[model samples]
Target: MLEVGSTLPEVSFGYIKDGKMTDPRTNEIFGDKRVVVFAVPGAFTPTCSQAHLPGYVALADKIKAKGVDTIVCLSVNDAYVMDAWGKASNAEEIMMLADGNGFFTKSIGMDMNTSDFGGTRSVRYSMLVEDGEVVKIFVEDPGRFEVSDAETMLKNL
Candidate 1:
């Protein structure tokens, strides 16, 4: 796993803005900014939909108030699915990023082979990045959601 002080890997995550798909460079997103990146194993799954994402949604303002320039919620799903989820969850503050190809996840050494669940996916984790460098990271154990919750990250911040 990428540790604290490591520079974020160069990758592009699909972004859906104004119903148009765009590829946003990871470095540009994190450049000279304090950003929070949270990865989920899959979107709309039980723990993810009911708890994980909501925790962040509930605390988005608080996290940003602590100097976070942006908050990103990442999953292996594509741009369209992510857009629908962002709307369904009312997560206007979070930039739902689609790592459809898992390139970013693999680069960070967080990719998991969840072929049984359909395909490759990222493990649940979160990192606090400042100016494109990681300052803090929390990776959850399989089938768990403890340390990476928004409340936990907020406390750290």
Candidate 2:
């Protein structure tokens, strides 16, 4: 698992931004920026939809006020699903990123799969990264949610 103070892995994946397909690495999305990146097992899942993304949306202003540049919500789904979920959840302040192949999640050593889910997915995790280095992490236990809430992340900031 990636630990605090570790340099974040160099990973990139496709995502939908403003209805356009984008590659984050090519865009240098995290370079020289203070970022809050959170991942969930899947898009539109119950806890992730009701709590995780909304928590970040509700705290978007406050997070920006604290000097954070972006709050990103990543999932193992494709860009279309991520875009749809963002629209449905009204996650205006959060950038919904798609790690379609679990590349980013696996690079960070946070990929897992539940017995029932039957596929590799990102564990519920949140990290505060500064210039591509991790400053803090909040990783939820498998099958558990809530520890990585935006409120807690804001408090940490």
Candidate 3:
């Protein structure tokens, strides 16, 4: 996994914004900004829908108050699904990014293989990125949601 002091990989991911598909590169979003990025295995899955994304959605304002320029929810899903999930969660303040092919997740060494579940998915993780470099990272253990919660990240900030 990408650790502290590692620069985020140069990758572009698409998302729906204002009814249009918007693809933004990592630099465009993380450069010159304090960004909090959290990745999930898939969208609308049990833990992610019930807790993970909701936690961030609920604490987004508080997280941003701590000098965070953006709070992003990333998943290895397509733009349409991501957009729908964000809307369903009432996550207007959070940026929902779709890593359609898991490229970004693989690039950061956070991708995991789930043969019976999903083909390839991202491991649950969160990071504090500033100016395109990771300042802090929290990666959850397999099948766990202990460390990468929004509350923990907020407390760290």
Candidate 4:
């Protein structure tokens, strides 16, 4: 899995803006910036919707106060789903990034197969990336939401 000092892979996210598909390059979004990226297994899942993303949304101001330029919530779902979730969750302070095919998660070795969940998905994790390099990474254990919470990250920051 990616860790402190690892450079993020070149991944592209598919987004829909004005009824057109937009694939923004990873570097274009994170390059030369202090970005906080948190990953969840799914967009509408209980833990993710109830806590993970919401925690970040609530603390976005504080996080940015620490010099974070961007706050990204990335999932393996499509752009439409991600966008919808963002609106419902009041995530104006966060950027919703779609990894439609799990390319980004797999490339970073953060992919997992939870048979109970019925398919491949990303492991819940968050990272502090500065200038395209990882400086802090919080990876949650299976079925747990401990180290990866926003409060912990904010404290660390």
Q: Alpha-carbon error at 135 in model 2, in Å?
A: 0.2
Candidate 2: TM-score? 0.94
User: What is the per-residue lDDT of model 3 for residues 1-157, given as tens digits with 9 covering 90 to 100?
Assistant: 6999999999999989899999999999999999999999999999999999999998998999999999999999999999999999999999999999999999989999987988989999999999999999999999999999999999999
Error of 3 at 67 (Å): 0.4
Per-residue lDDT tens digits for candidate 4, residues 1-157, read 8989999999899765555678998898889999999999999999999999999999999999999999999988899998899989999888888999989989999999866873778999999999899999999988899988899989988
Error of 2 at 21 (Å): 1.1
TM-scores of the candidates in the order shown: 0.98, 0.94, 0.98, 0.95
lDDT tens digits, residue span 1-157, model 2? 8899888767787778778998787137677999999899989999999899989988999998999998899999998999999999999888888899888888888889755774888999898988988899999987787679899899999
Clashing pairs in 3: none
Q: Which stretches of candidate 3 lie over 4 Å from their true place?
A: none
lDDT scores in order = 0.92, 0.87, 0.95, 0.90
Ranking by lDDT: 3, 1, 4, 2
User: How many backbone collisions does model 2 have?
Assistant: 0
Model 1 sits at a Cα RMSD from the real structure of: 0.8
How well is each residue in 40-146 modelled by candidate 1, as lDDT tens digits? Answer: 98888888899988999999999999999999999999989888998999999999999999998999899999889858899999999999999999999888888
Among all candidates shown, the one with the greatest TM-score: 3
